[model samples]
Target: MDKCAILPIADLYIRVSTEEQADKGFSQRYQEEVLRRHCEVNSIQVGSVIYEDFSAKTFNRPQWTKLFKSYKVNKGNRPQVLLFTKWDRFSRNTAEAYATIRSLEALGIQPVATEQPLDITVPENQMTLAFYLTIPEVENARRSLNIKQGLRRAKKEGRCTGLAPVGYINRTTETGVKYIAPIEPCASIMKTAFEQIASKTHNITQAYIHATDNGFNKSKNCFWRAIRNPLYCGKVPIHATPHECEQYVQGTHEPIVSEILFFNVQSIINKKREQLPKRSNIEYLFPLRGFLTCKKCGEVLTGSGSQGRNKKYYYYHCHSNCKSHLRTDKLHHLFVEQLKSFKLSENYYPICLKILKRTLTEEAALKTKTTYHLTKKIDELNNKIKKARDLLLQGDIDGSDYKKIKAGSEVQINILCEKLSALQNKQRQLSKDVNTGLSLFSKLRQLYEEGDIHTKRELTRLIFPEYLVSDGKCFHASPVTGAVKRLYNKEHSFTGLFSYNLSIKKELLTQSDSLIIEQENYETLGLSQQNNVSTSEVNEVMSLINTLAKIITIQLLK
Candidate 1:
């Protein structure tokens, strides 16, 4: 046998990151060639060539793990040497690299960095090995910091710092500068979807269907990400670090949707999120399966479809010991009837509007006071933080004490900032929310009647936050506390929990007449109402009309 054939077997481990693949020295091809030549020259037999296109930040790489497992499983035929072009190619983490090397030595396998070879027998070469391994780690950290700083600067300059959001495509200018611009059909589709959602004509599911039909074939998660991303509204979110504050910067790109419409969609998304648990799958035709509670057992009612001799039958029944069953059609009909009873009369529309306005006004005043107090508290905390820093500088306070006080102040500041942001958002959307509330309240019955199964379920859940079914009827129905519940209960004469006075009607009418520019405003808003309302003032009036329409429908049902 040849002397080289008697040499111990070795495995060549080659790795290259996507970026490093182009570098001749660090490339996989280059590393493989170097290892092969080194093995041949050193009279070492090559047993296997393992190639990996992955990061060396950790030892959990696919090829590395496979090699380790194969070695352990076939100990009799295991390679005595593991060869890589350089120490950095083996691992970027020094601690992990040293530990793994120790383990390889114990297993009778010597790991060698071909280009930067070190004999383990020499004590000085061990230190040299560590120094060589640390270079790559330091380089990685510096590269990461540079990338982060570059992104931050780009964001500050009003440039799109990451991948373009849906509805927009990234384009490079002739000057080698990149910018985001609206893409054809997709931009239009996104715009229409936003409008539909804002107008309550469609939910997220409907919007998703519309987009998919228009060639937006992405995952449901991607679709939601598009909907929730603020980048479409001309704002870029700067992610916060542990010590930094989160903020939104105006982008140079044209907005796909207005701020008002964007926020309205956000509000709708939030409301839908709250009702997600109650949402039913299309497989189950009965939307109220999990919503209803068994009156006797206090357990949740279950729903199922059964096939009879002639046809299929759907029903809701108690799951526990209590045996209670009702046909799906009968329960749904009763629920619809109960829902219609909440609609208000036409005469009561103006009255309800007046009540809602007063309630909102009082709420706005209370919020203003709360915001002011929070602002003052935040200012005081900031002052304390400044004084603490000064004391630390002067050596009046120890570093630990200053840090504790600074951390506490920062926590308080962050809380106050969050509260302030919430209050500001509420203030901005107060009018829009009131308008939506009045509009939805008026069309409650019509929406329920015309909506699909999903919408019907959502409406039912919103109207009755919690309810119990017993004796083929819904009982203990706990409606959400707001204008809808108040008007619904009052109209049905179900309860006498009145919270407003009718005396405010005259004053409210006077204020409404002055705030609205009756005919011209109506024409501008494309409304046929006779009342004189300003173009800007038509939202509240329109809301009242929507509310009236719903109430009128329900009243006719009665």
Candidate 2:
């Protein structure tokens, strides 16, 4: 009997990375041909040919896993040999390769590299096999280093390095320089979604519905990712490695949404996240059912339906010991009437508008100064980075030290850039915000009446930050700001509402200046401490000044 005829059958495994697929000699087809020819010449029967297009940095490959499964299922009759075109096709990690080869031998299967076959019977050939395995590992490491260096250079040149996000399409110029350009429909959809969320006219769910209606077929997670992505606002994030720090660099592509809208959407998204737990799963036609509380026991009021002689009646009552009950119709009617009191008087609208304009003008001037200073700081940091790079090139600083310093400078630069972006965005949106405020003020009552359940709840929260319900009447309904408080006070005459006390106005101006100083102090204490100066605090100070100005203007109207 011929020994060749008794050789065990073999399974051929072939793999090529994306980059290798483009190389003529290392293509999957070429690898398969070589492995098949070697098995034929050895008189070994061919069982199966497996192909893979993933990396060999790990042994957890799809086809490789399947091969192991098939061998275990048909152990006694399975092919006893595994063949690959080269040691690299088996694995680039030498330690893993050695361990895997031992495991294979234990399973009665022999792993063979066609081009570099090793005879395990010879002790010296084992060392030769280890050397062959190490060559691929070295080559893989070198390729990885070169790729990282190339990516760093591209990022430094303000080029996008990865696949484009939802709204952008990747493109390459005639010279082969890659770039991203905005794609149609999806870009418009994203802009509209951001605007809707920022304006508080719609929540994320509603925005998602609108997106799907307009040809956006991605999952909710993908939609949310697009909403949160800063790339839409013309900034690119450079990822960090274990040795290097991460940074955000301004992108070369055009921004689809304004920075103001993007930041505002982020703020809204955060608020929604915080509120998600408190939101009710059960739907109630009456918006105030869950929000109302009993004044006596301070227990949340729950709603229920009662059967009358001929019809059903809906009512909200304290589920606790206190027997307080109110019909939903009566409560809703009273709430609507109360909301009407928060609306601005038509005659006071123009005076209110003028005061807001003046205040915004002053704010714009201050913000412009701050933005200029931040820009100066950013430029200084950029200069420091350039100097660090130059030092590294001149061999004055080592690579590791240069990277450390550059990373620190880049972090500070990113912080300053964020601040500058916020200031510039606020300045750009000032006029639009003023107009929106005036419009919302003028139509507060109308909006509340026509709004859906969720909108009604939001409007209620805005007007009455804290309130109590007792004997079917709303009480302690404090306004959110001084301006709103003055509007709701029935004691003030229309003329008195418009009239300004010069002395009080002067005092408020001094207070506003002090508040600005206080804000600066808070910032110096760091961002965590700065949160103490809440949105309500800043709004209160600004509102007080505007209210004083309006009160002063009413005197002029007289």
C-alpha displacement of 464 in model 1, angstroms? 27
Model 2 lDDT per residue over 267-349, tens place: 78887445432333223345776677887888888887677896557788888877888888788878777666565544345
Pull out the clashing pairs in model 2: 498-551, 498-554, 499-551, 499-552, 499-554, 499-555, 500-551, 500-552
Cα lDDT listed for each candidate: 0.70, 0.71
- The TM-score between candidate 2 and the true structure equals 0.56
lDDT accuracy of residue 20 in candidate 1: 88
Cα-based TM-score, every candidate: 0.54, 0.56
What number of clashing residue pairs does each candidate have, in the order they appear? 9, 8
- Which residue runs does candidate 1 get wrong by more than 4 Å? 192-215, 267-558
Question: Lowest summed-lDDT stretch of 10 residues in model 2?
Answer: 549-558
lDDT of 1 by residue, 1-558 (tens): 777767989989999987888889888778888888998798889999999988888999998899898887888888889999888899998889989988888889999888887897899887788799899999988999999989987886778977887789999989998989999778888887787677655667767765765677687788888878888888776776655555667788899987656766887888844443333332235667778887777788888767789666778888777777778878777766766666554444454554455455656678899999999999999999999999999999987777678767775576577667777777776565544544555566666675545566666655555664656755455555443443454553212122234565444444532133234424423344444333434444445444444443322221
Q: What is the clash count of model 1? A: 9
True-structure lDDT of candidate 1: 0.70
